[model samples]
Target: MGKDAKRSELGQFLKARRAGLTPADVGLPTDGTHRRVPGLRREEVAQLASMSVQYYTRVEQGRLQASAPVLATLADVLHLDDDQRTYLLELAGKQTPRRPRARAQQVNPQTQRLLDALDAPAIVLGRRMDILAWNPLAAALLTDFSQLTEKQRNYARLVFSDSEMKRRYAGWERVAADCVAFLRMEAARRPGDPRLRELVGELSIEDPHFRQWWAAHDVAAQTVGTKKLLHPLVGELTLDWETFASTTDPDQQLVVWTAAPGTASEENLAFLASWVTTHSPGEADDADARADPHAGRGTPPAS
Candidate 1:
């Protein structure tokens, strides 16, 4: 969509969402007099967000793009949860999806082998966090990749759309925002890819949070980070991850997750390995297919 059309759509959506709220919803005191607007006035929003009324007006009018920090402030003022915040951003074109071209090679066989050999959970993922290839350990720890279609194997999609995956994450809110920021960074790196674009579009339409977070224009590259996972079989584990670029493809990264030695996380990892051994591949595949990533998980009940 053109900038104007995109902006207008987002503006209207925000307006409608805002109208549903009262001053009390955001801790503001209403005068209880005849008010011209359904929601907080532009001046009230600007005061709460610590911005100028003109700037807030520009934002609501879709005449200017808001930075990540500014968007965060606006989200706070609007009492936007993760989904609403993300949808607002997407509507602003602050973030565009990755669009992968069919002609491009997303992953190399050698890299896939490297992932398979890693004793710990590891995966070769594309710029958009697509599971190009994941080792048995990674599949066992998370979801079985064999069951997911090439299109449904995205990390971002799983975070927001899959119930099991969402439950696995300790802080779903932080994970969701990080995914958006990371994807934004990837988009800057691979602007020509059609798969990225399609994924972004699909997600934007599917979740309001994705749309709002996408609009914030945040960029992040956390190649090495810690993720807290609540494994169904093994309890909670904090896994440290490291990402390395594939030798053959700069766009592909090998992500590996490891835990501290002699810790409870190590014990959990061991348990995950055993789960993979007992569960039949046929059973897992059927379950994952039913958990399609593009399918919408309706905006989580406010907060």
Candidate 2:
């Protein structure tokens, strides 16, 4: 989609939200009058929001531009959630999704060190959820990102296009839907990003679910969450993941996945690390070796 489509996005988002609510839902008295359209009418929204019906109609029709404050008011009136409100305001030009500097291609050395120090799966993601880097544990738990092309090392790409990814997740459709929502949030944050545009276009063409989910206009930000994976090697792992943003790079974030201390999941993680050490040799060793300077190096020369 282009600039015109941006207007369409804003309009559709508003209409979708409105359609999701009813007169009773918003505490409006039903006059027993038959409704022409679903949800609250434009007049009711305008009245409750303290705006003119004509203005609200124009805004919904994507004909007139409204101020950020005005859009914020509408967001409140619509009872938008935090993510939804942010997405709505972003679409209304209250924020710039475009980066002032170049989109990040690499993570800082300190960040990489942090990943190396972790005992669990860790990954650094750059703009458009590209797999910028990952710890060996992550490589073991997830696919070996090192073996993939740059274009192929994307979260959305893998979740949608890779057959193994579908089987990896216990509930593939929910995970895939969330991936689409995350991409939508990123796309809103950086409108008309060519690379982002290309990613969406490709997924829309090749994947059936991608097209529908993308069209849903849902937006989501990564947060503390739990993921259940059926690992081919170690079996089931229910990992908890948390996402932390980089202060230097807004588009860069670190995601760490760990299992509870004494659960079977944690034991499986240990087994996975061992499997990596055995198969890849040095890429993933025991927990202490993860902190060692030469964790995976060969035995030292005899003195």
Which prediction has the highest TM-score against the true structure?
2
The TM-score of predicted model 2 comes to 0.61
Error of 1 at 203 (Å): 1.3
Clashes of 1: 29
TM-scores of all candidate predictions against the true structure: 0.59, 0.61
Q: Which stretches of model 2 miss by more than 4 angstroms?
A: 1-104, 281-303
lDDT of 1 by residue, 1-303 (tens): 888888788777766756765554343544559988786677877897889989878878888777867876676556554556668777765663332334544666677677767779988777688878888878767887778887788899988888878877888888898998998787666543446666775777687677777777778995798899765455678899999876767777888999999987897687666555666434433344344323222121111
Q: What is the lDDT of every predicted structure here?
A: 0.71, 0.76
For candidate 1, what is the lDDT? 0.71
Q: After superposition, how far is residue 131 of candidate 1 from its true place, in Å?
A: 1.0
